[model samples]
Target: MAGSNKDIKVAVIGAGALGLVTLKNLLEEGFDATGFERKSYVGGLWKYTLDETTSVLPSTVANISKQRGCYTDFPYPDDTPSLCASSYIDDYLQSYADHFQLRPRIRLNTAIRAIKRDDANNKWHIEVAPTASASDADTETITFDKLILATGTNDKPSVPKIEGMDTFKGQVLHSQTFKKPEDFKDKSVLVVGIGSTAGDSAVALMGHARKIYLAHRHGAYILPRLHNGRSIDHGLTYNLMTVQKLMQRFAPNVATNMFTKFAQKIQDTAFPSIHEHPEWRLSPAPSLRQTFPTVSDELIPGLESGDIVSVPGLKRVTGPNSVQLDAPKEGDEPMKLDDIDVILFCTGYVNDLGMSLLEPRVHPARNTNPAWLALPGSRGKPLARLYRNVFSLDYPDSLAFMGAAAFATPAFQLYDIASMAVAQVWGVEAHNTSTLPPKAEMERHVDEQHAWILEYARTGPVYPQLTKQFEWLAWADEAAGTNVGANLGWGAQGWTFYLRNRRLYKLLTSGVYTPHLYRIFPSEKRKAWPGAREAIERMNQQLEDELKTKKV
Candidate 1:
């Protein structure tokens, strides 16, 4: 439906980081956009407040990379550090919302129930439910020309069904329910899983909990936030996109090996032999050699001082107050702890799109495994075939899923790219609707792209290489009718490349052209066309030469 300004009415699901950014970008582009947040507040997972069940203690919040996470047009405050807490992020989003007058369009405490396409009118019928705790509730239906699912996967915590979990007398909760470290003060606590949150939560609860047992079924690479007096996270955040590209082009194995070694070191120093855990499955993301959370100066001394202890996975919970562990060292008999006040299941969240409005489009066959297709669905029909991770093949002028990948760069950056693509789609269709590609052709293209990514991931890192971001953007921009090569120096890559390339100071913000443009364009174009197979083979050879010389 058209709005007062002849703008397209768009419904953005999820008001967290991804949603907030998507909504803001849409509004900025003169689109009549409204946001629906399941939670009462903003900031999605980043929002932190006191809860009676869990006490607040000194702990590091989700550290948003101001350089990478903030909008390109808006710079983060200079005073802000590389890592800021959830409160800081919440405040930042609020300020952005206020600055752009985006609050009025957002409907807080509103949850989306279903989204159905009206084939007759070529519109999307969205069903939204209020967040009020009522069993028999009426849902409000709204129609919009476009729908954006910014509902991030991280927002939902995945709780695995473990044997004898419910019988435990001690409180068991997901990391989402965890408020602070003080709640486990002087009590024995067992933390399950070993993702970013698990690492951060374990470190935070070190001193507070009398005995902290970190249960990991398998080994994960532990990266420190800082290395050589510089934030490794900064390197990862700022240069990750480029580094990923370099790795993809030159030394795929070297790139994977570098991160594997780094994770091994962290395992050796902090929790030796942890990688040998029977349940440890290698991560799909490219390994960061020294990428660990930035432990606050105050917390490091305590960790070394023996306040926190990392253990293997949880074997079983014998009783309400007692638990057993699959200890790291052999001959270290089955360890048991008592009087456990709280058990923080740092186990990760499941990305179930069918649970949300993306269900109707999901086919039963694909529903069994959503991650397999990189599309959101459970079992039935496919929602939309992904085109280079952005546009959908089946729907004309429709692009809902981006930043839906299980683990990659933060969802915020992906949302930015998606918004830009959406705007482009709107702009392109407004001019000539006939230029759009056929759905069948687009589907084949997407299937090929997915196959390529899957093969690439198998030979390389577990997660999409950082370089894939640039690659995807280039392809997406082209598909959206924008000149990615020309926009690189003007968009996110412009600032990013400027920071890393010392020779391009004059061209940094001048919008001046660089010679790399010529080299990059041909390489990207070759990768996009039927000649990509030969291009990739040639690129692999070049990468080997570069890696042998660099010896990284």
Candidate 2:
């Protein structure tokens, strides 16, 4: 059946982590696929350099462990640390490419210029140009039967223009340009925004910078990287996905209270000095269920020790060397900071969805369909009309966006599963074995999901792409005709698995839910990797061994 896709030519844009996995899945399903990357390397932003490319800081470490970070089929070596460094992640991605023989199919230094839909012939016309460092290849146009946009969400950095910023004598930069700790050595730096980057930058500057001021608009639940000497993800978060879903569904308020209470308890236990020093004003969000968390081992400690100061939202720039902050409450007086050398805005990035590359009408905002327009709060949002956050309602058969949505789970595994779903839908559509829902039905489903998202947003922060891992797995599995949930003891088929295989069932439910388990079962759409079971067992053993030694 894989041979049936030889005639289908697929073009994948952006060769980052998601793009690499997208290309791998397209090729695995036997599509004649080619990947385009603007950079010379395959790791995208993970391939760090001082150049304009957005990358991690020199001291950056993965927020999650390698077990969740790596691809399913390929597990990290036993020697790898539980928390991988940026360099390790970069090397691991390169290893993934080499192991799968994907480099030959990739065109490094080739950048996509424009993509036009040929409605008459049902093909995509893509224009590409080689970068300056690459060979002097002339710009060329290529045709493909399908297009996948893996360009990623972090393309356009969100930098706000503060009033009197021009008068500021010191340097003002976005976190995208932050390189190393030495850049701000012995200087007073004001790090804006309270996300992971803000926490990281503040903590990384701890002994280097003379003073660090962390400013934020709202409160955040700062979680520790380690709890009781074990990685928090492996010891606490990974095993609670099912419980999280159950509480969210049946008792929403109760779940919110319990989670927030537990998070506060952890914060209090980890950083006891914060409670004693009320003037520091590290007010946490009432419900962490709404906003993303800031994870760091030293951020709170730095703040508690008076090395870093926490302040309210930035109000305005007062002078070249000073800035005013908002009152913490309605009655309190506003605060001001002076002698600041650098103001690093850790404000995040907006997703770039083929804005300039594709025709204007192809964008979600320009959709004229009544059904799409009828969806509440769907207008003007680029990714709102997507069904399952992959297929386009207008051109479901020809277009899909990989790594479009943001999830707390591992990025690589999510993109791989989503890519497989795309491959399966396109692979079978040609021969009449299609499992794709009809166009109108897809529009209705998209509208319903949009409504649900709008309702969920009313409770907390506006995280449009924040999705649950199991829920995404359920949708992706149904689209690909896979029984991953059933095989892994989730949903209705979980009962059958529980009755049939008790040993595996116990491991699947109680043990770590590693990425490899997704590929452990057979599927008609995609072949099961024989090594998946071995990978799962190896990961379990590694975790057990680490726990025995307390190296976690």
Candidate 3:
């Protein structure tokens, strides 16, 4: 029951928005933490729910950019509107958990139910309950030395088992239970995924659908949450981790044809009809990089008013009013689609519900679990092995995993710099436990980040165990000193200025001048942070003078 007051506590789990900024950066690193959150309040998935395990849609906004999707000690209200809504990022994450009182250390409505570890007091246990369990069932458990797992990956909704989709007849939703498109008003839907909830839920159910339909197996790169008006991640995803290490020092087909022709010239000026289908892109394997998409502030308009249409994959389930599709042009024949009253499925979730709180005590049948992070497949799913995906090479310092990956960082600045590098690797065993590291150097950094995420993620996506948010928060502040890599002042002379002019020092330090001029100050004996780098350089120079005075 873990309360002998041995002192070293911490339990975390999921209060969302990276577990309330990893319980306020592990209570500002003193760390006698708590947390929980099975919702009763807290903006996990930015709140706003009709709750089908939250995936957000109903035209969900804030697809990053309330100035890099805020929260490094709050900054969203300059009369709020630098791309707002998803209820203003769930009221700026419930006013950043009640402005840091962190609502009396979290635990609302609870619900864990099994974490187990104890291993002769190495500590962990967990088990919890209460989503209102009174029938007879009960739980409680407790214990803890460490165990963060800040429920990152939008849990639930990985749908996709087509073939008869459980004999689909009519209404079949699941864009994480889509909050409300007036429940497809005049009906005739059919959405399906390519994401950003299949193009903003087919433009928020095209004014109450009488015809909608978007389907899709490929051709994405939707983008545009304001391009020329700024914040279409203001170029190179406004700092793709030092532009993928200065384009992996060039010459990989010259950094993949110079960042895929600058992401096909920003999708030929904001999606010229999805760049006129370079054969519906996503690759028949020729290095798929239309430069990340499925973004959308709103842009669907074509079909000359017949009311939205795109259809292509899903060649099955034909009756209960039709659905065949996939053929058009490969000898042209598979159409069907007929009257379909509703089909939705913006299909996304499945970031492994924290793989039933992992059990792996030295290969107990090796299921290094994150619900199988996939790859040795017959169709991959469920996997986890983290070396730098936040510890856990078979439970090092008792499990840690905040926000698992940073798909384009700033979701709590890479989960508060990997939860303050797991409290600076548990304050390195109270003074230099041989400055940590070994365990085959964390299994060779999780087998070189799982062979660099199976290089190009083999053709599936979510692989972001943080692709460079200031080089993984300066390699977790140089393997856990947590000064956030000494405030990225990284001067060994900037690796000899990135080995001399690596693309003009990565286009003059990935904009916002020097990749967001530093902030993780939990102490390196108090360096900069007072004025926080000149108020983020006068708010990135008044957001590049308000995106260069937007007019067009």
Top TM-score prediction, candidate number: 2
lDDT of each: 0.55, 0.76, 0.63
Q: How many clashing residue pairs, candidate 3?
A: 8
RMSD of 3: 20.7
lDDT, candidate 3, 405-468, per-residue tens: 6554456666665665676566533432213478998788666655665555555554444343
lDDT of 2 by residue, 1-552 (tens): 334776899999989998999999889878899999988999877877887668887788888888777786788777788888888989888998999999999999887777899999999999888863444357788999899989876676767668888788998888878877777889999999888989988888888999899987677777887777766667543337678767877887887788778778877777777677655555646346435678887887787688989888778899988999889777999989888899988877655555447888786535434433344332223444677778878788888887666666778878887888888888844432436788888888777766666655555444545554457667887666556666654566777877788877777567776777677777655668899877777777778887789752
Per-residue lDDT of candidate 1, residues 78-133 (tens digit): 56665666666667877777877777888887767767888688788877777444
TM-score for candidate 3, residues paired by index = 0.33
lDDT at residue 123 of model 2 (Cα atoms): 92
Instruction: Give me the runs in candidate 2 sitting further than 4 Å from their true place.
Output: 1-3, 132-137, 236-240, 278-280, 366-383, 429-434, 456-460, 489-496
* Deviation (Å) of 94 in candidate 1: 1.0
Query: Candidate 3: lDDT over CA atoms?
Result: 0.63
Residue-level error in angstroms, candidate 2, position 501: 2.9
